[model samples]
Target: MNSAANAHLINSESYVQKPFTLPNGIVIKNRLLKSAMSEALGTIDNVPTMKLATLYRRWAKGGVGLCVTGNVMIDARAIGEPGNVVLENDKHMSKLKLWAKAGTCNNTQLWMQINHPGKQVPKGLNKNSVAPSAIGFGPALTKFFEIPRELTENEILDIITRFATTASLAKEAGFTGVQIHGAHGYLVSQFLSPNHNQRTDQWGGSLENRMRFVREVYRSIREKVGEDFPIGIKLNSADFQKGGFTEEESIEVIKTLTDDGMALIEISGGTYESPVMALGSNIKESTYTREAYFLKFADTIRQETTASGLKIPLAVTGGFRTTTGMADALAHDNLDMVGIARPLAVDPDYPHKVLSGQAKTNPIRAISTGIKFVDDAALMEVAWYTRQLHRMGVGKNPKPNEGAISSLVKTLLTSGYKTFRTRRLRA
Candidate 1:
């Protein structure tokens, strides 16, 4: 074994040795969690494919304590992306169990992230998306998405029930938990954002009214799954876009969840309008350039909440890829867990590499700098190569030569009309 691997096995004490206990008493052995990343690997009918199972099995063996599946749409009409896994009925229970087994190979906890795309729905996928209000996603980015219809009061209630039903399915599928995708300007987030939820009904107008949907969803899940089942939420600390969900509103929402017995709260920010990809524009840049992306905001939330005597486990993710940096944030910043996304997508065994001393720090800079965000054609090519690396138990990194094959693979993967390709194609 290499020195790094040897060290990981021999070292009794390490920086990442800390564990986080969830509300249901489920304990995560380490702080590292694989944040949800959309792989677009599901079947056209929104079922889990063999390739999707293979992709997760590789990540399961990578050593992260927790792995959250990409957006599992609660409403079939409200799909986040074209190929997102949909979990609206019991028909997928067996397949989901298989997926759960593959994802939990290393005793790692696997959580399904439930979401509704709302007005952020891409035009090509669902031209008639739904939101709390008829407000568009601003004039600049309206071209990226279609005009969304405002959901009726009954429809909102039905959607909330759908979230609970999905959570129940997750429990039956043997998933460790379910994470409500309340961040990134999704359906739940649309209600949270003042800009998007401009309604005169009971579901809008004030922060409490806006938060009613999420609160009901959370409560319904608790009722269905029982008190001991873990239920997590990913929330935007702030929208970053003007006239949107602000830090003040976010803090209030956090407090409400804490009071209601949330298992964990993962803090993130940004929307389609002020996308986090706009380099150096928001606090995410501060995480890379300054350190602890939500350090200031988190501190304020923590101090005030602590002063008020509320103790909820808080997690922060975005631009985190260093052992020293993560350790510092956990120790000094009062954070309970750290979430990592793209890095693990590239290297599934990154957590093991870090723990075993094979790698001193997360290789975020190299991988992220190599990421070339381009048009759909370019992105498809990149996704193809990424799928290959994921199956081989290797992390994705931008390699120039892989682009040609990736381009071909992307077309094959996205062509919904094609029959299921054999697993050999993935290998």
Candidate 2:
């Protein structure tokens, strides 16, 4: 309750409460990290707003050691959603600085997750989408997304520069660090997926070439941000799609990044096409019951990294639901941090509850619209959670028990309207 009492609680002997120092010498006060969740709280012009500051300040005070903001687009023309913040330059530096300050309050480490949506952009949201190769999605997704144009070599180089520019601006705005959104079927992930990247150039065709984009992006950012600023990445253990990014390739990428001096590596799985990150589909049944869908894979990577003598801090996101599960994973040395996303949307102070031993299990549950079509679409859950984030942006508490169908309808209407507005502006 009080500062002294809270400090004592945080300094407890529990594994979850223990502070850990990153290789960059930055110390996170505890092991709890609020993983990136698309807040969609930016302004229509794709600029940071005070609502972001308000929402993150709440999470900062609620007690997360590290809070990673949702994907901030590196390029305005390649936005994944309508309200995503685009950090192309310093035009909105003042607002960005405000958000950074609020999010980094109470000794929290706020990292901005930078991304480019590639062909994942919703239809009509962007005039055109680009990827490593000119390819279209499979039948189910084809109606929602068009075949993206293959990025020219010059365009690819420009994008690498854009990633660096965004990271530089984030550091200048006072964000403690930046995480490459190299997971989740975004641009970086698309480059790594053989199913998506069919290019025959130096940037594709082989595992080394496929991963060249991410390696270059990381190097560019590190060059701009300098050695002291922490730079991490959220990578997929496997894309869970046939001929997609594989576990073996993911491990190789991890080793390469480690060799390049990555400060942290957060493991995740799935893409928009497979969408297995939250559902735990195809993961081992034993790991599912433990509440960490990727723990088995994480442990394997942990062993590999230990054997290779890579000292990069590792984290795993998705399916972390209980305090016991979070603590036990750390006690077993599976990961250095616990990445919680949707749970914090419902209860912002969840980390404090977990640390104080007042909360054993997380309150998150499967959200369903009850309508088969709506429930089948993975956007339903994200929309429901986004509504909670919008509530928080307005200084209100999240409605954890909110009806799923109502949220679905609201999201559909809102998304349709935003898409129309975005298209009109482009026109």
Candidate 3:
């Protein structure tokens, strides 16, 4: 497509500060969605803390139309990290209500990203990690994560119920919406990967079967929330691994949900193993020029789905750093919203800056010491960004200029020790 044709395709200015309406009739005030980032601020009991309320209030005031909370594990026994919040029952309603109010002030929609960590659960975190098939994280990841056992038929049925229960609890606690965490190699994501899910039963093997878990989870949540409440899903464009969940399969899964009246679909890719979703990967020079890392695949989706006469509300997250990139994607109708994470971590008011013409460019600071190994550590990014969130949780401004090495040391000193000591995992 020529620049003129691209300009003609979806004029880049039409959606600057535009309000977005989901298919289920929920109208977001703007096109920016605060993508889910693990806050790890819960109490020892896996309950929401006042710190979470404080942190979200900051983001609510930051001008995002919708804010998706860090991953809320559906079952307490299975968690990806030490401070992960779990919503298995209504016991934490009061704290949840407080978090909800802070997040929903000014008409902002706070959608809880509910998930099950499955085999991704760390060693010693839980007695036994489980998945669609008994698979171990390959050699590179084995040291950090435990080998998982295959879930039994009964266990699978119970997990589906757990998802619905959490969704119902979220609505009761006053959240505006719920997003199923079906991406980034969580439980649902694992099921989608042919390499991970090898069962011949209805919940595995074929693509249709592999998708059944997510489909059923969506249906269960819908039943609990009724038809009016919005439900969104964050899905991978591809797993970016050989013999893993393919881009073609992802489109098919998306179409199935779109046909079933899914309200929103956010595209993200990679997992803890590949970690491309965190912007760590070999990239083409052309890719760096684009705002979102997944837009190329998203463009492929637009082509395929439009040919089928379907238009789903799409949001693409990752590598978005400028207004021009955001505007072009929205104007061209490639995506309905921009899912901003790291940029929002440091500057909560990034959407405001973009909409109000104040932010020219927010530089993504490289976290490195010039030592190849230290620079290449995956936990370095998580450790750095997570500390920034803790600062906001405690009413402190994010130390965006903090050195990467110091951030990692502080995080290990603070969260790492506590995480290792806590047996908060579900039994």
Candidate 4:
């Protein structure tokens, strides 16, 4: 542990395998937190399916301290991707219970990641997306999304209420916690970015205004869930784009979350345009060499949290692939927990493997297709990984050696394509 970076070193015991207690009195069984990944496992009508339960059941038995489910939309009409589960009402209580039961088995804490896509909603699935301003994604993503309309004040308040309603329902279900999805260019993230949110209203313009949406969303959730239930957030260290959300703004937001009694804040970066969360970039050397996509920012955040004597737990996700890096980061108090997503997709038990020293190295790799279109779209990455998840959901082992190009073609030509089209065709 380095004293210069952090005043205290994580104890010698493998912090990854120890229990982590949040400020809210919710104690996670371990430091290995399974960060959110868009599962694409719901029915066309936005109900959680048994397949989703089966997949989560596997992860629960794998011994992760916390498992954050994919983006469950607050409104059915504003989904971020195909097959996203929606908690807009109570009609799906049975389905929610079924999914939550399996996910939280064996003492694993399951938290639903609630979100609204805003303009990130795909083109064919939506008529007109709503945002802080009438801005569309840049030209590269123009064809994939529609130009968004600026949200009215009433509509903005309605969305905030929806978030609270959804969080209340999540608590009613078997979920132990709920995480507000304020990153990855989702609605809250869009409002936080000055580049996307250009409104002159109270919800936009200055840094305080731009962050208002997220603050309100958190306050709403906290109102419903109370003090004991854990409320966390997955936020970006920076948007990693020119004139986008900066590290300084992000640190301020972290401080705000801490003040608001946040249980945890998972650090990640990039939006659709930057995609640094998935592909990464050269701007931060620690992201690659140190194996924490947001460690550089995580260190600064650690210093901030320590200086303020805030107890809110911080985590770094995205680039983690080895135990050594995880240990080092944890030792220096750069982060309190380790977040791994893609690696767990292929091997649900990777956490156990790392803990037991059975796996010597990280096997996670970048997805690619020989053709330009599939590779450039980044949908290939999602489709390729979906294959592995489907395998796990169906009680089969993941085929990590499966060809990416073949997987894309099969998804487009087979049941995966049908399932996707079924959801989109209805919209």
Q: TM-score for every candidate vs. truth? A: 0.85, 0.95, 0.95, 0.93
lDDT of each residue in 155-176, candidate 4, tens digit only? 9999999999999999998899
Worst 10 residues of 3 by lDDT: 5-14
* lDDT at 342, model 1: 60
- Against the true structure, candidate 1 reaches a TM-score of 0.85
lDDT of 3 by residue, 371-409 (tens): 677666667787788888999999999988898777777
Candidate of highest lDDT: 2
Show pairs that collide, candidate 2: none
lDDT of each: 0.74, 0.89, 0.86, 0.83
Compared with the true structure, model 2 gives a TM-score of 0.95
**Model 4 residue 25 distance off true place after TM-score fit, in angstroms:** 1.2
Clashes (backbone N, CA, C under 3 Å), per candidate, total 6, 0, 3, 0
On lDDT, who's better, 2 or 3? 2
Which residue pairs of candidate 4 clash?
none
Local error of candidate 1 at 42, Å? 1.1
The true-versus-predicted C-alpha distance at residue 138 of model 1, in Å, is 1.7
lDDT of 2 at 331: 69
